[model samples]
Target: MSNYRHHSGYCGIEVRDMHPRIHNFTYVSSCVKYMIFMLNFIFWLFGGLLLGIGMYAFMDKWHSTGWVRLETFYDVILNISLVMVIAGVVVFVVSFAGCLGALRENTCLLKFYSMCLLLFFLLEMAIAIMGFVFPQNMNSFLEDKFTDKIIHSYRDDPDLQNLIDFAQQEFKCCGLSNAGYQDWSKNEYFNCSSPSVEKCGVPYSCCINATDISSGLVNIMCGYGVQEHSVAAAGKRIWTNGCIETVRLWAERHLYTIAGVALSIALIQLFVIYLAKTLEGQIELQKSRWAA
Candidate 1:
């Protein structure tokens, strides 16, 4: 029998004999295919980790609270747990499709993966554009509603409370409103009218030395009744600026770093989409040869 060499273009395998049985030969580039799979796999693992953490947090809160009413759903989403769950689900679904699609060389799955990535990229672009076009509106949303919701719900959830505390300590700022530490008054536990000892007080996290281990012990009650003092007096003990202002300044300082990171993420996504599409085309071409 005479040997007939068959070569398919672009990462196609060489065949010694022109037999239809060679249909199983891989036409896609191994590098591209594996790269896609690995990328999705990493994200898949991350999604699963987020899902697990979210579930644990949610369940722990539920166990501690003993009951969850339908009326509390608004507060639920505002908390980090529910947010994590939603984010995890989205990431998991999209990465799952990508992982399986690349491994199986399934066109439909690859199409779905690429479409999802495109949608995400477009949504991010739109959000970035809107932020630039209407900076005041975006800032208003964050300064007014978003910050208030989180501040109001501060005492309602431990995770959220910790998060706000961490932000306060890290940014060296107190509260989310312009009133600075006085914003804690919005919290039911710290409200001036509240009977709790913590009334009119900000969390320990708002203290200047909250995280300072130099003394070998932290003064958790350092912020107690701090609001009763004037801002001038409190300024000596705690941060006087609101977290909103502090964070805004921080963002401005690191604007270039943030932009670079965002741009890199966008480009990486586009590159992955390109690889998926290229592999899909290569597979289609190989299938056509098989049919011929």
Candidate 2:
């Protein structure tokens, strides 16, 4: 009878010990892990595509130019090819780490992905704060240096030239410079002193009726020598207003939409970071259980 009682007590204690405590639980949530993995996988594919396209564009530009002379870091940052390449690389790396880490249950990759996202979020916040605090300085910089760079570099790069043309046509405004359509004088071919036939002329994109209605053909020479006339006279032929003012007005009109998009991006970043961190925690917990 005494041996039976002792064996029964030991069996009861062993049963109690087998009950799972919070830290002892080894269950890994597949839902959270797979959700993070799928979202990151989609982003990874997009990033890869962007990276490939950016690489091709950069290489082509380099071959055509023979050399790139960037006077400052700002110049390098402003370069379309370099900008696309940098953005692509960042997105590709971050998304790759996130997806692989989540799928493989890797703590190291998850940590890296989370860190990058956090850093990006902080940087964006800082830029936003600076914009709010230094609106005048930002506006001055855009008006002076940025516009000058775009206008002068327009003919140097086909992509840039097309982008400027599209902006002018869409905004129904001429140059981004303060002088408006007269800013064409800064271009070599359009300069008043230039011997080219396009001298003192704005691009056809600035013309009001550059396309024929019946034939549906564009009149490429519509803006020829338009800038040589007075503003009152030229106003009848081409858009006389500067793109800067037009863009400012457009922003004012679409302020809510812009804000909503920015907020959505921020929220998405936060959610991704959260998911990454949660998966990291779960993996760590599982590893701890294994160790115990």
Candidate 3:
């Protein structure tokens, strides 16, 4: 019988030779762990890349248009990007820890790494909820704000009034003065021309009627010789264009990617834990056989 040593309080502990098959199993498990660690590392790298791109797009590269003012929206998007950057960094760090723990067979480090993965998973869920709940409404709110700004600016400017009059006289439209042109595009009473001069075959009037001017209303009237239909059409176009389908697509893709990374990390950690438990069990069994 092999010589026995006391391990802590336990006695008759023999260091038995591991079976060749058990050694092979350990080697295979090690290889699998390494592969999983590499895969997690790749995911971390990609997440960082995505986060950087989002930050640049939201904070550095985007510019607001005349009808798509983003002063408030910019701040919101900036905050979201900042959160994403932080999450990416956390994922990278935790995944690295998990790799190290697996290589070193450190159970403590593995538990901490699992916690990080859970943190990121929760964050992704929160982001997904926000995206689904507010993207469309947020877009519409921004559009309305932009339109209000344009109308308010025009209403406040005397020079704009003169310009509108000139446009109306040139195009023969009653301009902003008539109630018929108040919601001219939607109202059948006004003879508003097509948005395009080529299509309308007529010049548009760019004046506001006195009766149509309210104390607080914004003037949406275009320049003289510009059709009311054209101006209204242009406004609608700007509003629609600002909130494209691309924004929703971007949000959805990011949410999915983040969730996938978190899940992958979790699976890897579980696998490593299983391997450790198996190795421990095998070591115990070998000691039993040697004692027998």
Candidate 4:
């Protein structure tokens, strides 16, 4: 008599627990449990992929995560990678716990998963706030790091060399010293002050336009002696100014987009945490009903 009864859902304005107080009745729907399980499964699948990629990138950049030697100027170079790896590790672990909980319907794993999600959500929101509030800190650090020292030490690391070349080409700027590829002087081969064979030469990245983008058709000589000419004469031949000004300007222009992306990530994590909490609550309620 208590388990079976007739009742209308009150104009389709359903009440989940109104009858629980009136009749001590409870409902545990397998559909809701399965839905939450599947959601966690999907979330973990994508999270695993992101985690793997982030770890790979971090390892590749530092060779070993042990002691990443960044001189004083390069100290902040690890900031981005460190945050990403930390976030990636947390997401992976939470997702693993979620997978175990969903598959086994274990209360302990679900509780851990929910708690981890909340903790990570709060941490990310804090970081996003700091990132937006003081974006200049990052910009200044990068401007300092991307100086003539890179050109002088470019050959020391293949990764650093590639990054420097990419930055010059993308920003359409040149040199550590002044404009018109004079910055090339910092490199031994292009030391115009010493009058070497490669003196006054610029890398192909400094040209107004590349001969080939796909194949990187470099006129090693295209940059040759271009810095010897006056700025007016070199206007058509090579880029002027160091990357600092242009890159800073670019960051200023795109600052809003960067902040928006950070906010969006925070919102997504908040939603995920909400979902985990709701599922945990529902599971607890279902357990109570089963015991009754």
Best by TM-score: 1
Q: Highest lDDT, which number?
A: 1
Clashes of 1: 0
Model 2 residue runs over 4 Å out of place are: 1-27, 62-75, 128-136
In model 1, the worst 10-residue window by lDDT is: 67-76
Model 1, TM vs. native: 0.86
User: For each candidate, what is the lDDT?
Assistant: 0.84, 0.82, 0.46, 0.67
lDDT of 3 by residue, 55-136 (tens): 6644542343222223665433324345566666666677677667656655566667656666655676676555567867
Cα deviation at 153, candidate 4, in Å, is 5.6
Q: Sorted on lDDT, highest at the top, how do the candidates line up?
A: 1, 2, 4, 3
Model 4 segments more than 4 A misplaced = 1-91, 105-132, 145-153, 175-202, 212-216, 225-235, 241-245, 254-260, 287-292
lDDT of 1 by residue, 1-292 (tens): 4546666655786656556365557678888888999999999999999999998888898899885433655665776887898899999999999999989888899999999999999999998776656766776677876776787778777888888888988899998867888888888888889999888888888888765578777787788888889999998888878887788778778878978988999999899989989988987877787788
Task: Estimate TM-scores for all models.
Answer: 0.86, 0.85, 0.37, 0.58
User: lDDT of candidate 2 vs native?
Assistant: 0.82
Residue 42: error of model 1 in Å? 1.5
Structure candidate 1, residue pairs in collision: none
